[model samples]
Target: MSEYHLDIFMHIPKTGGMTLNEIFKKQYKLSEIYDHDSFQKKMMNMDELTEVEKRNIKAITGHYFYGIHQEFSRPFNYFTMLRDPVDRVISSYYFLRDYPGYEMVKDMTLEEFVVKGPEAPNLQTLMVCGSQEIPDIEIAKENLKTFSVVGVTELFNETLFCLKKEYAWGDIHYTRKNITKNRLAKDEVPSDLINLIKKYNALDIELYDLAKQLLNDKLQSLTEDEQNQLKKFNLEQSL
Candidate 1:
């Protein structure tokens, strides 16, 4: 089987994860799992599952961050997106702070935010990606060791282009997410706060940098079914 057949689209929240997951499902017809807990909680809470259940899973999506400490490794791939920490935290803070599930951050500032708070987005980010905790570069790479095609969210279109050219897919375009319809700059984020965000989201940054280096102009390394699926969907959209 082609590497892309085992493609795993890791869900990194507040970074266009939702929109991208849709694309993978629309294109590949792979089993898409989101809301994350379905897999992470199942895998984390349970010690084992029957081989039938394992074969039933084609594409596990919706945020399994780290490498699960189990012998469930199969012919599968891994993938996710990364964004600038400063922007990610800021974006997440606004998107969910006032939402029902994120009541904790209803009135907190980035400087005031902590991981355990109700509005803690990173915690969810880790869970969705299958990691037990937040990631650093070395740790994330280790966690997603099974992934074959890792894409950078900030430059997602570029990554999609490569996936299209290399794989049988023509182009994997997706609608952007977490866009602010209005603009209001309340206060400037302190440089120190920005630095803190960068410090914490180091793993994402490293992944972005590494993906840029490794997958440059690389072709003939994609699954035909995945590629054809993407191409057909894109054409249908055009018509």
Candidate 2:
């Protein structure tokens, strides 16, 4: 039997995924690490960590696209977190531009940045993980097919509720997000890019709706504004 019920946490950047990773590491005896920066290592990360550390590992997350491959020799569960595509794209813009590497783009205005998008300097990582490549929606669904659960960013507590039913994880700690003062980046994503993201990530949208329907009762408990927030998308195109 496996020590952990593995969940992938298909990370949609700036969508509280790291917060999830932090909770997994600090709260659960099992530590889930997100290998965002150095994905080249794969299992070498596990090999290098202390056995005690490895034993505490419950999951590995981040925008690990392509395939699901882990060194752990046991059956495991899979899960990922997703946000509405529009917000997701906007966050990607800021995360890349504000954070490291994207310093090259700091000088460009949002209008300039949107046109330059994906190709914006040092934004390859954000492009690959964000809507630029694999749609955030598709990444979440494809991840869901591989894992037992799909955690909605809009309804994360319930996602954890389901997971904890099996793991008996105690009091999941997390800060609820709302009305933060941070300005949005890539604020007005052009229609062309919006349609492009839809084409690439059709499945992600489907999965998110499916997840919402699956957790309707739990989601209904949210505020009206919070409930509508799920529909926010980077594009006006009909999905």
Q: How many clashes in each candidate? A: 13, 7
Model 2, range 74-132, lDDT digits (tens) per residue? 45665556665555555556656666677866676644554465533222222323444
lDDT of 1 by residue, 1-239 (tens): 36424456667666677777666666543232322445423433223444654555555565554553233566665666665555666777777665677787777776666343432434433543455654344654455444455556566665665654444463456666557433223246777776666665555556555655545433245467745755665576456
RMSD of 2: 8.8
Worst 10 residues of 2 by lDDT: 230-239
RMSD of 1: 6.1
Query: What lDDT, from 0 to 1, does candidate 1 have?
Result: 0.54
List the global CA lDDT of all models.
Answer: 0.54, 0.52
RMSD (Cα, Å) for all candidates, in order, is 6.1, 8.8
Assess the local accuracy of residue 79 in candidate 1 as a C-alpha lDDT between 0 and 100.
Answer: 64
